[model samples]
Target: MFGRGFTLSLSVFFTLFIVFLYGPTVSILVLSFQGPNGGLTFPMRGFSTFWFESLFDGVGVIDIWGAFGRSIRLGLVVMVLTVILSLMAGLAFRKRFLISSFLFYATISSLIVPSIVISLGVALEFRIIDDAIKVFGDNMGIQWVVDDFRTTMGLFSSGLGAQLTWTLPFGLLIMFAVFNRFDPSYEEAARDLGAGPWQTFREAVLPIIAPSLIGVALFGFTLSYDELARSSQAIGGLNTLPLELRGLTTTVTDPTIYALGTLTTAVSFLAISIFLILFALLRRRTNKPSSSKRSTL
Candidate 1:
């Protein structure tokens, strides 16, 4: 809105901010790979693969890996659940009113609730359910499976649901952003061509919004994976990476904790890079044929 000088000033400001934030992160990453570790020397006491080797040498690396895997699975489930719930809520409230406002505030409140408060409520509720199981066991022949597969699933789903309190709001916003720009004419055309509602959605609407859906899924999954407070509170029996990392940092003061931190950051960076590459490829694939057809026309 101003001049090139304004843009240059903004760029410089952001550059300084990024450097300030990432400088320590870069230093730790470099230090994590250093072989000889006394404290935090700069020049490194001769290069060696000690740090990387130590990752699996003594520490419970297998447990860390298991936690990482569980986090990934939980993240995927949370993302899917968030997307599904958001899609339904968004579509249902395309025309907003009092109900829409109420739903919006209700969904957002879950995000605002303190993690400790939510955790207390969840724990108390489960305890009551356990008590009920005992009472039922004494009265009836059926003993409730509080620790069974079904119960575990319920806990997992509920934990993810607690995450969805905020996840759904963001997801819904994304869906609305996508649908706002969508051209209903395409759907109408599909119908005019004798396509059914589901067929129109599959063939026309989906293709138009697939990128947004994928973007939302990735964003929500990343958020869920990195979340610690909610995961700690809601996940009764499961341990996620963030929780594991915290426990290690607190209980075990090993230098390998730095290695774990470096690994986590590296994995996140790699995932982001892959997503960017895939997005660029998708855009190229979508554009090339259209450009070629336009040239021929």
Candidate 2:
């Protein structure tokens, strides 16, 4: 809608904006590799991966690799669940359901709630249930497993739930944005071609909206991986990467935290790259003339 001059100015502005935003992240990444004797600021003494290796460093109760693995696993589960549920909810929202409006607003409310409050609720609810489980174990002789499950694997349970509370709204909102641009005639054509509901969705609708699904998955994974607030209490006995990083603040006075931040940022960047590659490939595949004619929804 603007002239070429305005367009060029906007482009330059965004370019500078991106650089401004990523400048600190780039600095952290560089500092992450600071040498053994190097301070956190600058003037590198040498270079080494000592900080990375010292993540656990037999330091304390923290298990760096274990927490990292838990975070990855939880992020994947949350991503998959978010994509599926958001797509289903989006489709359902288009129909005249009995409680569609109620459900939509409920989803919105979850987004509006403070992360800490939601986390507290999750923790309290789990505590109550665990207490009940303890009573049951006391009587029925199933004590060991119930006693320390939180320390061992509570993230997959309560932690995943807490992450979902935040992720699902994002997924649903992305689905809404995607469905906004969707043309229903594509689905109608698939149905006209004798495609069953599932078949139509699989062959037609999904391929068209695949990019947005990737977006939802991307959101879910990143948010869950990087989440600190809700995850603080909801993660139960064991900590995730963010919690580990926070715990390190008091004891760690080196580039180790920078290394951790760099590692996390790399993983996040890797995820983004993979999703972008997949999204591009899907777009290209669906954009092909012959394929588009038959498969584009």
lDDT of each: 0.71, 0.85
Model 1 regions lying over 4 Å from their true place: 1-8, 40-43, 58-62, 95-99, 141-155, 286-297
Q: What is the per-residue lDDT of model 1 for residues 99-138, given as tens digits with 9 covering 90 to 100?
A: 8888877767776788777666766666676677766666
Best by lDDT: 2
Q: Score candidate 1 by TM-score against the native.
A: 0.83
TM-score of every model? 0.83, 0.87
Clash count, one per candidate: 0, 0
What local lDDT score does residue 136 receive in model 2, on the 0 to 100 scale? 77
lDDT of 2 by residue, 117-137 (tens): 999999888888877777777
The count of residue-pair clashes in candidate 1 stands at 0
Q: Report residue 75 deviation for candidate 1 (angstroms).
A: 1.7
Q: After best superposition, candidate 1 residue 102: deviation in angstroms?
A: 2.6
Error of 1 at 223 (Å): 1.0
